[model samples]
Target: MKKITCPLRWILFLFCFPVVGSYVCAQDSVSVLFIGNSYTYVNDLPGTFGALAANLGKELTIDSKTNGGYTFQNHTTDPLTYSKIHSKPWDVVVIQGQSQEPSFPDVQVNTQTLPYAMQLSDSIWANNPCSNVMYYMTWGRQNGDSQWSEINTFEKMNTRLYHAYMRMADSSDRAMVSPVGRVWSYVRANYPLINLYNADESHPSLEGTYLAACTFYTSLFRESPSGSDYHPGIGAGEAWVLQNAAAAVILDSLDHFHLHPVDEPTQASFTLVQNGDTIQLTNTSSRATTYTWDFGDGQSAITEDAQHTFGGNGIYNVQLIASSSCNTDTFSIQVTTLGVHDHLFDGIKVKTSDEFIELTSSGGTFLIRTFSIDGKLLTEQSLSNKNPLMISRINQFQVLHLTDSGGFEKVIRIF
Candidate 1:
């Protein structure tokens, strides 16, 4: 799939060519299957998410099976949802319950939402161990749930909904929550001009759906959708409002909503600068209080930041272990100590824009290798005679090691 650079053209393309079920089964694509009620279907939340992904130059496949006013229990009992989970490998399976179901009392939610959520999560993991079960925490009714006397206001309803979804996610190993409802609360409180509710005061209006799409994009991709061009026919002005609203809620505190999958722990990230045979490691890990450094040469240090000198290195694996009360993670980098042979690329210039890595030089064939911050090689390509080479989809936070045939090397970090 070629990248679409123009936002307007991309929006046109999305409307002209609506994605079908057949279009979503592609190799190496990020596949998400949404299973829920009308909340997941109205304004085509999955389709909106697809457009948002395209805007960000990501290959995404979205498919949803939704029925009006259906609960998670109904979805668990339905065979189609089960078959879809088993039919193909999905990167994410988003589950949304009926609007009022999660806001109900503890006894009701425990007996209703929790059991069905667990059942659905088990089915998803059984089908694909890698699939992440995301609970779509939906919003309270526009006027609040009249049936539930204990939750008479939107604030109370959303509060209950938040706790219920959090409990559900915390109970399971593979489950996480996408706090779309919380984003709605923020929008409603701050942006009064943007009406999220429809005439019924329950289902989302177009703006509401757009906000939901932005929240999903942030939750699933772990990237903010603040400047995405795909607006799904909504005016650019309104789209901007919703996008900012989504970012303010989702990106401000991602851990509050449990956006990341349970098995994926916090990452240990650091920057390294080499001078002669000594290397300096700067610890920049998040949510970690302690650090352990391993130079991979029988030498290690227990500090947040340290300097290590190699005996006489060809290539050594340097590892950092960052830990907190909740999680522990390790990051490794292969550092090549060339003694006096380390020369900077004098004429080479490297830069990044959006997803592409742009390399510029007067002339020469260069070996460009992309690697994770941990030093795992991602791609190796030789650019011959091409003064500028642009590599796409290098969007994650990582390091790029560029070496020319003349042995000059440059290391750049993308964060």
Candidate 2:
């Protein structure tokens, strides 16, 4: 019994709902903050979501700042919303846009919805660089929009909402979309007896909220909630249907929702080759496209490879920072060039070629080993009586530890 033609119009109602309420309960816990309108505050969606998380043996510290009919644009301007974002480092922040705003024309959505969504997202990252930004992806109005001609049906409105949410999530940071409307579409087609609409053919009935809660559970945990014993006021059979639909729509298509395949952290490391007061830096970082180096003398450079000269050397702590779109890593080392010159080690002649190092021993069985500055044993070999020893590729400024058969030691500094 979808809406045919209602006599009334409903748009933009503002009522800031407040609720009264954390523990180290489960092995997995997440802190989520919901910012939306009645769609989120009605059934206490955050509370319901927390209950579902606890039911599944996971913990959720849920909170919300909901005012009826709040839009993403409104949140962008509201001081209260900014305060909430800066309150703490939320593990995840769920942004829900106004019901009809996203379903409007594409131009309207791009102008009104997407930009503000991006603003909010930027704020989220600025506050906590590691926080995950998620869009709630509300369902279409139960009946449809009576005022608009193009989206006069539930199917049409739902499609537009999908597109808008997807656009918001398609940014470089890659936010997650819960796809609640997508799951709602599945249920309305498959489970008719469950009235998702309360009375005005809009907003969510208890069943609708439960359905949303199930959808969110799957979206957040990436697991099906079909067998959870805490269905609350709904029958187990009905709840199972909702959970399965969520699993089918979201769980089955996780990549579509941008949920799976967590972001890989940036890798940062480097090696140095020092010649007098000048040193050459080779970037060994991985999973990073950009790099920044701190020469520790109030000087810095943004490049993959760098050569910096110290002003009459002491010890310099050189650092390299490697970064990607969503991740950052840094590595640093202490380097000195006080007395860097050609030195003889136990009368063993050393020759340096482009990629290899050759060592000649004057008729003695000594062990030759190359080690990194951090004392890691890079390579080791026993030098037989008088044969020339050839060492494969080695970084400049690397240290070589030499010991005679009598266990006497000499250290040769090479660059």
lDDT (0 to 1) per candidate = 0.74, 0.74
State which candidate has the highest lDDT: 2
In model 2, which range of ten residues has the least summed lDDT?
1-10
Name the regions of candidate 1 deviating beyond 4 angstroms.
1-28, 261-415
Error of 1 at 130 (Å): 1.4
Over the stretch 87-172, how does candidate 2's per-residue lDDT look in tens digits? 88887888988777888887777787889998998898788776778888887777679778767789988888887787777652
* lDDT (tens digit, per residue) of candidate 1 on 1-415: 1111212433344455323242343334778888886677667788777877787887877778776667889989998888778878787888888777777778777887789888998898778665778889888777676665766788888888887887787665526678898899999888888889877677788999999989888887777787888886678998988888778777756655556643453447676656557777777564456888999889999988898989995788899998865578888887877665444454555554433666776667778887865778888877655647777743353766767677877665444
TM-score of 2: 0.61
**Per-residue lDDT for 385 in model 1?**
51
